[model samples]
Target chain A: MLEKNKLYTIWVYLQAEPLFWLTLTIGAFLVGDYLYKKSKLNPLVNPVAISILLVASILIATGISYERYFNGAKFIHFMLGPATVALAIPIYKQIHLIKKETTSIFISLIAGSLFAIFSTYFFAKLMKLDIEIIYSMMPRSVTAPIAMGISELIGGVPSLTAIITILTGIVGASFGTFALDILRVKDMTARGFAFGLASHGIGTARAMSRNETAGIFAALALGLSGVATSIIIPLLFKLINF
Target chain B: MLKSIFIIFLFQLIGESIQKYFELTIPGPVIGLILLLISLILTKSTKNIFITKTKEEITTTSNFIIGYLSLLFVPIGVGVVMHLSYLENNYIEVLGVIFFSTVLTIGFTALLMEIINNQFKKHARKK
Candidate 1:
C-alpha cells in the first residue's frame, strides 16, 4: 500500500507544480516546430498555433485551469518586454533603408493603419457584433501590449483584445506569403512592412525567417506602426466623439 | 549573454519611466528601443572604440534573441485558451472578421506600397 501510494503522490505533485507545465509548454513548442519544418514551413501549420493547441488540449485533459498554467508560463511572458526593446537592434542595422524610403514608408504606414482601423470597425458593425467587441477589435493590428492598452482606454476588455491581436498575428503570419505573391508585391521592403504593420511581432518573425532585409524592414515598420497607431487611434476616436 | 540582456532590460526600464512621466499610452519598451537606436547611431557616427565594441556585443546578443523571439510569445499565445468561451459564443463573426480583414489588410498594404515604390523608381530614373 505504501509503494502504491507513492506513485499517486508523485502524480499529484506533478499536477500541482509549475515545472511540469513549463516543460509541457516547451515540449509542445518543440513538437510544433518539428511539425512546421516537416511540413516544409507551411504557414498554415504555424508552430505557435500548433503548440497552443497541443498545450491547451493537454491542460483541458488534465483538468488544469488556465490560471495555473499561466503561473508556470509567466516567466516566458516576462521576456517579451525585453525582447521588444531588443527590436531596436535590427531597426538600427537597417536605419539606412528606413531613411532612404522615409516618404513611401510613412505614406504606407498612414494608409495601412487607417485602413486597418476603419475596415475592422465598419465590418464589425456590419456583422452586428457587440459594441464592446467592436472596441476590442479596433486595435487588433497593433502589437499585443500596445493593443491591450488601447483596448482598455477605449472601454474594451483587455484580455479579449489580446486574444484578438494574437489571432490577427497568426493569421497574417500564416497567409502573408501567399497574399503577397497574389498581390504581386515585389518590393521586399513593402512586403516586410506590410506584414509587420498588419501583424506586428509574429509577422515580423515570419519576415525575419524569410530573409534579412525583409526582417529589418519588418522590424522598422512594426515599431513605427505601434507608435503611430497608439497616438493616431486615440486621436481619431476623440475627434469623432466616439 | 548576461551583459547584453542586462543592457536590454536597462533600456526597457528607461522606456517605462519616460512612458509614465509623459502619461503616454505607448509602451515604455518601444520608446526605450528608439532611444537605444538613436544612441547607437550617435555612438557609431562618433566612432567611439569602446562604444563600437559594446555595439558588437549588443548586435550578437540581439541576433540570438531575435531567433527565439517567437518562443517568447508562446506563453501569451497560449492564453487564447482562456478566451475559448467568448470565442465559442461568437465564432462566426469573430473568425470571419479576423480572417477576411487580415487577408485584406496584408493585400492592400503590400500592393499599395509596391505601387508607390515602383512609381518612385520610375520618377528617379526619369530624373
Candidate 2:
C-alpha cells in the first residue's frame, strides 16, 4: 500500500504548495471564462465573478485559509498594476474620437463620475450600510484596480470593494442596455459613455461587442472616469467628513 | 511578447517611482498610464532603443495585457469571502443599494449625455 500512501502524501504536499493555489486560480479563471463564452458573453456570467466563486468555494471546501490562497494568488494580483498601466493604450487610441465631441464627452464624464459617487453614498446611507461599507462602495463605479485602491485610501476593505465592484459591473453590463433603451438614448456615444462611466470595464466590453462607435467611446470613458473617480471620491469624502 | 511585457512593466515601475517621489495620492500605475499616454503621443516618431518602440509595439503589448485584465482581478475578488460576516445579516440591503445605485448611475448618465449632445447639435446648427 506504499503507492496509496504516496498518493496521499502527494495530495498533502500539493495542498501546502503555493503553486497549487496558483494553478487553481488560473484553472478557475479558464473554467469561468469558458462558461462566460458559452453563455454568449452574458454579462450575468461574468468571468471574474465566476472565477471568484469557484476559487472561494474551493478554498472554503478545502478549509484553506485566504492568506494561504493569497500567498499563491498574489502573482495574478500583481499583474493588476501593469494591466492598469496598459489602459493607456486603449485610452490613447480613443482620443481621436474624443476630439470631435470634446464638450459633450467631457461633460458627461464629470457628471457621470459625480453621480456614481454621490448616488452610491446617498443610497448606501439610505440603506443604512456601515460607514466602512459605504467607503468601499464609493468607487464601485470605476474599474476594479482603481476602485480597490480608492477603497483602501478611504479606510474601507479593498477586497470587499473588489466584490462590490464586480457586482456593480455585472449589474451595469446586464441592465445598462435595457436602461439606455428605456431612456430613449439613441446616440451610440452617449450610450457608450454611460456604460463606461457607470459600469466600468464590463460595460465597456459589452459596448465594444455591440457597436464600434459605442465601443470606442466606452473605452475612452472607462479610463477617464476611473481617473476622475480616483481623484474625486477621496477628496469628496474628506469634505463630507465621510 | 517578452519585449511588450518589459515595456509595460517598465512604465509601471516609472509610474510607481514618480508617484512615490511626488508623494502623489494617485496610484503609481495610473501615473504610469498618464505618462505612457504622453510618451506614446510624443514618440509618434521613434528613433532609438529606450524610446524606440513604435505605436504598434506598445499597443500590442498593452492589448495583450488588457486582454487578460479580468483574470488578474480574480484573486482579490475572491477575498470577498472574508467579509462574509458583514453580509450574513444584511446581504439584501447591501445588494439593493448596489443595484439601485448602479441602475441610477447608468440611467442618469445616459439620459444627461443624450440631452447634452442634442443641445450641442442645436448650438452647432445655430452657428
Candidate 3:
C-alpha cells in the first residue's frame, strides 16, 4: 500500500492548477499536431500557435501568475533533457547517411551558423537597437537554455532572449516550408539542415514529420548549432564591442 | 525498458559527475548524450537492445512532451510582467531587436542554405 506521505504528495500534485494548464496546453498541441498530419492546411495547424493561444487565454481570464503556472508546468520542463537525449536514437539510425554526407553537413553548419549570427547583428545595428538588445538578439536562433546563457554572457536580458527564442521557433515552424520553396531548396538534406540550424528543436520536429533523412539531419543541425552558437556568440560580442 | 532507463540514468549520472568535477561549459545532459553515443558505438550490440527496449516508450513520451515544451517559456514570459517598468523604458529597442533579428535570421539561413545546396549538387556531379 502507498504510504501516507506519498499519498499527500500525489494529492498536492493532483490539486496543482498548473497541471490543468499543462494539460490544456498539451491537449491543444495534440489537436493541432493531429490536424496538421491529417490535412494540407499546415499553417493553421501549428502546435505552437495553438499552445500560445491556449496559454494566453487562460492567463488573461484567470489572471494566474506565470509563476503559479510554472510550478506545475516544470514537470514538462524536466522532460526536455531526456527528450534531447532521445534524439540520439533517431540520430543513431541515420549514422550511415551522416557519415556519407559529413562534408556537406560541415559546410552547411559553418555557413549557416555564421550567416545566422552576422545577419542578426548587421540588421540590429542597421535598426539602431541598443547594445544590450542587440546582444540579447544575437543568440535568438539557438535553443532556449543556450540562448538564455548567451544573453546573460553578452549583457542581453535573459527574459527577452526567451521571448525571442519562442518567436523564432514558431516563425520557423510556420513559414519554413514556404521559405524553402521560394529559395528552390529541393534537397531533403539541405531543407532539414536549414530548418534545424535556423529553428532548433521545433524546426527539427517539423523536419521529422517530413522524412527520416530530413529528421536525422535536422537533429544534427539542432545540436551542432546550439553548441556552435554558445561558443561563437560570446566571442563575437567581445570582438564587436556589443 | 527498465534497463534502458537504467542506462539513461547511469549516463546522466556520469554527465553530472563530469560537470560537477570539471565545471565544463557544456551541459551535463549533452555530455551524457555524447558518452552514451560513444559507449553504444563501442558495444554495438547494446545499440540494438537500447533501441528495441525504449522505442515505444520514447515515442509516446516524446509526443506527449513536445506539445508542452513551449510552456517552459511561460515563466520567462511572466518575468516580462514583473519587469513592466524596464520593458516600458526600453520598449522600442526591445521590440526593434526582436523584430529585425528574427526576420534576418530566417532570411540569411535560407539564403546560405541555397548556396550550399548548389555547391553540394556541383560536387555530387563531379563525384
In candidate 1, the residue pairs with backbone N, CA or C atoms under 3 Å apart (3 or more residues apart, or in different chains) clash, namely none
C-alpha positional error of residue A187 in candidate 3 after TM-score superposition, expressed in Å: 1.0
Docking class of 1: medium
- Chain A: TM-score in each model: 0.94, 0.81, 0.88
Going through the candidates in order, their DockQ values are 0.78, 0.64, 0.32
lDDT of 2 by residue, B37-60 (tens): 898888766776666545677788
TM-score ranking, best first:
1, 2, 3
For candidate 2 chain B, which ten residues in a row score worst on lDDT?
B80-89
Number of the top lDDT candidate:
1
Q: How many clashes (backbone N, Cα, C below 3 Å) per candidate?
A: 0, 0, 0
Model 1: per-residue Cα lDDT over A1-242, one tens digit each: 99999998997888778788778888998998899889887888888888888988887787788888888888777887888888888888877878878889999999999988988888888899998998999999989989999999888899889899999999999998899888788899999999899999999988887778888888888888998998888899889865
Per-residue lDDT tens digits for candidate 3, residues A1-242, read 46988987875665466667568656755766567768764754675565556665666676666676667667666666766665666666677777877776777677778877887778778877777777777888888877887788777898777766766676676777776776676677777877788887777777777666776777788888888888887776668755
Q: Which candidate is the best by DockQ?
A: 1
The C-alpha lDDT values of all candidates are: 0.86, 0.81, 0.68
Best by TM-score: 1
Q: For every candidate structure, what is the RMSD over all alpha carbons to the true structure, in angstroms?
A: 1.6, 3.0, 5.7
